[model samples]
Target: MTERAIVAGVPVDTRHWIGGRRVASPGTFTTTSPVTRTALAEMSRGTALEAEAAVAAARAAFPGWAATGRAERARILHAVADGVEQRLEDLAAVETHDNGALLRSHRRGVMPRVAHNFRFFAEWLLTLGRDDFATRGHTNHISWDPAGPCVLITPWNAPLMLASWKIAPALAAGNTVVLKPAEWSPLTASLLADIAAGAGVPPGVLNVVQGYGEDLGRALVSHPGVRRISFTGSVPTARRIAAAAAPNLTPLSLELGGKSPLLVFADADLGLAADLAVEQYDNAGQVCLAATRLLVEESVAGEFTRLFTERAERLRPGDPREPGTDLGPVVDARQLERIDGFVRRALAAGARAVIGGGPGTGDSGTGESGLHYRPTLLTDVAQESEIVQEEVFGPVLTLQTFTTEEEAVGLANGTRFGLAATLVTGDRARAARVAAQLVAGTVWVNCFFVRDLRAPFGGSRDSGTGREGGGWSFDFHCDVKNTVTAPKGWRDHG
Candidate 1:
């Protein structure tokens, strides 16, 4: 199991990693590459039995792991980071091959962040502060205790990176983990288990189970032994998980879907604004935090639209493995059809497609037909239209004009989602004013997608529940306890 077998010319090791060993499932499922529209690998299709085993293993390992010294945990986490860095190129390649995102992005942006997730949390654990104070003649000491076994369910869009975001914090807080990566992309998650073992993580400390959400995911979240659950996926799935875990009353953190907006004012730099708008097309618009809804001031709408359309059309779509490819195919044919359906319905509803409006062929000619969708920009859509109100989750952008500042804010906040938003303006007062009013968990003024690992990251309303990053992450993974003691001489006096 140490070496991967070649499937369709891609190296793949498909097995469940449980109790620090590779466990074979009763059945297997094939995962397809969006770029080639062909079978990429045969993955272990986990059942409830596998899920139960993973949970048991995590539970068995929890006590020793939780009791491990902070310094030793930090050292082990650092070693994990070192292991990730050593396989940076290989991991990036496998991620791109499995998920169809641009290889350059995985190599330069995503993979580096994966390593940093481990390293940053490792350092944060040693320096993490707890409150200690005296009040009412009593001294109180606050400490965070590990919350037992944790189950982390990650999405397919950025499998390894996002998984680490949850994994690092859980491990840093001294909790054992059972990771269930999205079925569409499980190769990297499997590889990560190997990486963890190589870095000296003890058996049963970290386990990975690959399968659909209905069976494996349900079992993992509903299991009574699971003390904490963190899931990143669609709203419907989150609701289901919540219902499943309700009986057990297991603490849950859910990061769901978003239809984020980007606001552009007349005073904003047109060039920078346009650049930010086009960034929504990155990852083929699979990003949960992408600003798919563009709200522009009427005075600058025409100018901004022209700039955005020009840059978007110039983007190169090709094989993700190519260094020059700016955009890759959507995850699969099903996803491609979903994107097309959204655009078609919008068009029929009288919205105009200013640029690309349908399926596109890859420039590399290596992929199957209908795998690529052109970067699309829509205009003249009503405020209440489905295109504007829903999360397309594709390379599609909808533009709406706002007559006044109040109207702009209304349009931006109209949707049920409140994941993230971007405000483009030169006036510092207006930027601060509008940013404060935006109903999103994360708001960027004069920038987009700029992330600081220590900053809080999550959504509001339908976007998600709870937050993660820095102390917030620790808050979710650990139980904060307050120890109170009476004044030293009070008992003597009594």
Candidate 2:
């Protein structure tokens, strides 16, 4: 951690660099404050030439770097952990200021996960090896190795955290990279690139460009030199990345949005589940794995609403960086408008606001200014309500009731998105049965928004394909290169 990195929302540097030298023609763009719409930094957007420079630098370093021993890569990643930990506060503040995400989200959600991800991938790389498999008088030494240069595109919601999800593993797998970050939030990406370069990473191994996805993202993804693309964003954008990847047959891993369901069974712990589920809305339900839909058995819907509303009302919304503020406004004014629009559509179509509803209140998005939305719960929402079908991505939860266990599972799986689900039941048999039947990638028996860097994290259906966290990511970066060989003796012609 350098004292030079110790600053408060200033434009640090703009020249595009490769292997430690600042080069020419770095185009300029201004980064705005999501909180107040003020210009925070004047960044140099990467032109196609600059983008090419990054790709070319990565290409130049690929052979020597990828060919290096995995242990050497691991040591550098291990050093990154110390750098990240030392600068955790700076990172968190910057994330909150740039993305308008909760401050602790970076401290708790991003930082530890970033460190753990680096360490986890470092360990995972050591276990992968090329080995000989002999079968029926034939033998082959299967070689699994790095796939060369990788292009990673991360979302603003969890920028650095998601960056590490791809960055740490791609490096650990021995591939060089050129990362393109969302223009909505590029501070963390730029900071991370600087950190990686400073943390003993040989230059050209990592590159970053700050700009709109349409130009920069397209250039990075469509480039012929990129071997693999790892993207985390919306479904539409993922589709675009897929199309760009089609011509080159570039390997891809997409992690998109979700409309997760939280099923409340008759025999479940209503009080506890309601507390945890709605309590999470303080972060304005921006979490991808949040219980966006509450599907309760008819026998428990009444009880579920009672408990959920009681807890939801207690959550306070205000400035995200503040200590007592549980819920901040959604990321920006656009998101706040979208949240309002989603609720209006639901209300117009015959849904009732059971608890805090309408536009944001208090210090959150005031009637005329800032970005904030009230923690709201909508009941009596038609099963076909837009709120029910689409991801609100705000501090809102829609409710629907089911009669049987089968009905609950059917309703949960009925949506196009299947990212996460929470099943609450006292009986192990019932929990086990329903958890397995759920369509989501992850099913929490009684928990909500819980995560571990060492666990496989991803979704099914429109939520997107591919898994992150753990050593599982190595598969996303490195390809299976099975080498055919025989033991010490020559090719036996016996």
Candidate 3:
């Protein structure tokens, strides 16, 4: 409602920000709006050259940044948080317009959290200190050192927020970084570069390169100067990056895809379960940790299904800019089609649709238009079916039944991905048992998607490679060095 935030339909700046300046590339690509299926802006396309330049800048700045005082680093981070808060509305508007995320969520959920990521890491860094312990022969000192130049690659689903997750910690730990945001949603990232510079982040300590992953991503991963890489996206892409980075032997922290499960027991509050089940369709179910698989106790399966389907039907799909829209369009046509294909394949393989099962009309008065898919719920879906096993990454939920606690645990852990899981049970013993049995990095007992900044967040098996949060994130961005020295006039006792 401010003039700067009047961004219902606008094309934002699309140039790269490197070394505290705007850098343009020869080739460009048009980013299309998922809400209108129209060209939003032509972004400057970066290639190996631009990526190399960005890396060189970061590498050059690494030594100075690493030696910066902890207090100064924390101060800069605080300033960055302050800058983001100042531009919160504008950034939220740009994200909703570029990524098709519901504005309501961006305003209330995403943007505010972006500032939190910076503030949390900044405050945490202040608590850190060198550790020293005495041994028989010598005293050992352990300290964390910066990982040097690092590349942060974030996906488009929650662009600014996810980028903040990587950028905040990397900088807090005294590493210079080159951020390559998904081309589909690079506007706010561009804005962030300016904000960081304005907040007194030294030139080259933080840079942004806007381009497709294939060109820029490969170059960034293999660059010798990039000491570390933190990426969040699909599993297949993570695998590719892992292979590419193997020759360099660079450290990588990948938070890849997920086929997370949500189990509802007979003792759970059925209404709450149903409500949370429908809420999984947030962001049109494009979240990496969305509850795609729903396991229910056989005794209450039918009742839960009925309530969930009713809630799913009432999900108000509309344009993301609309005030009351519950669901927005998918990121693009390809993703929307992919979601539909999954539903179709499941149905062909004998899954039953309890409610919506196809593309939505975008007429729910939520203001949605392009690339809109209905909130779908399917039952009778086999555990082995692709829809149930794979990461759908859309607003589609598959239902299955389990009679026993052991069966539910088996079903929940069946998927290769193990990013997250949720268990709804009133029985304290059952909650603890199932939570421990579920093979996920994070498990919510009788709740869904509640996260603490200090808690570790990542997956097991095929989901990801490392944990990141609070100290976990600090560890990833830093190298632990142990120093040992003999005390004056001391000798080995043993």
Judge candidate 1 against the unseen true structure and give its global Cα lDDT, from 0 to 1: 0.90
Candidate order, TM-score descending: 1, 3, 2
Q: Against the true structure, whose lDDT is highest? A: 1
Candidate 3 Cα deviation (angstroms), residue 40:
1.5
What is the per-residue lDDT of model 3 for residues 1-494, given as tens digits with 9 covering 90 to 100?
11121235443456787877878888988777787777667788899999999998898899999999999999999999999999888888888878899988888889999999999999999986666888996889878899899999999999999999999999999999999999888778888987899999999999999787788889999888788999999888888899889998999999999999999999999998998788799999999888888999999998998898788777778888888778889998888889999999989989888878998875645466757888888998888889988888889998899999999999999989899998888899999888988999999877788888999999999999899998989888999788989768767699
Clashes of 2: 5
- Once superposed on the true structure, which residue ranges of model 3 sit more than 4 Å away at CA? 1-11, 362-366, 489-494
| Model 3 C-alpha lDDT versus the unseen true structure | 0.88
Question: lDDT tens string, model 1, 125-190?
Answer: 998876679899798998889999999999999999999999999999999999999999888898
**Pairs in steric clash, model 1:** none
lDDT of 2: 0.77
* Highest TM-score scorer: 1
Comparing 2 and 3 on lDDT, the stronger one: 3
For model 2, how big is the CA root-mean-square deviation? 3.3
List clash counts for every candidate, in order: 0, 5, 5
Instruction: Give the per-residue lDDT of model 2 (tens digit) for 103-195.
Output: 776677677788877888888778866456676656766555789899888877777888888888899888998888777677777677667
Better of 1 and 3 by TM-score: 1
